[model samples]
Target: MLAVLEKVSFLLKMKVAQGFQTQIAGFYIYLGLMPSWSTRGL
Candidate 1:
């Protein structure tokens, strides 16, 4: 039971970390893309 709980906790932490990384990557992509979009708009 303890092992299972530990596994669940580890997986949850991994998922949260993955989510944060994905958000940061997405933010950078948006930042990277926006300049081109604005340039096109002009």
Candidate 2:
């Protein structure tokens, strides 16, 4: 029972990490596009 609980917790941690990574990637993509958007607006 304890092992199963541990495994579940580990999987949860991994999912959280993956989510954080995706958010960071999205932020970087937004940052990369900002300059082009600004230039186009002008």
Candidate 3:
């Protein structure tokens, strides 16, 4: 029973980490796009 609980918690942590990484990647992509957008505006 305890082992199962531990596994579940580990899975939850992994999911959270994955979500956090995806957000970070998206943020970086947005940052990468911003410079081109600004230059085009000028």
Per-residue lDDT tens digits for candidate 1, residues 1-42, read: 999999999999999999999999998898787878686775
lDDT of 3 by residue, 10-41 (tens): 99999999999999999889878788878577
Question: Which residue pairs does candidate 3 place in steric collision?
Answer: none
Residue pairs clashing in model 1 are none
RMSD of 1: 4.1
Q: Tell me which of candidates 1 and 3 scores higher on TM-score.
A: 3
For each candidate in turn, give its C-alpha RMSD to the true structure in angstroms.
4.1, 3.9, 3.9
TM-score of 3: 0.82
Task: Give the RMSD in angstroms, all C-alphas superposed, for model 3.
Answer: 3.9
Name the lDDT of candidate 3: 0.91
TM-score, cand. 1: 0.76
Cα deviation at 16, candidate 1, in Å, is 0.7
Question: Which has the higher TM-score value, candidate number 1 or candidate number 2?
Answer: 2
> Candidate 2: global Cα-lDDT?
0.92
- Lowest lDDT block of 10, candidate 1: 33-42
- Model 3 spans > 4 angstroms off: 36-42
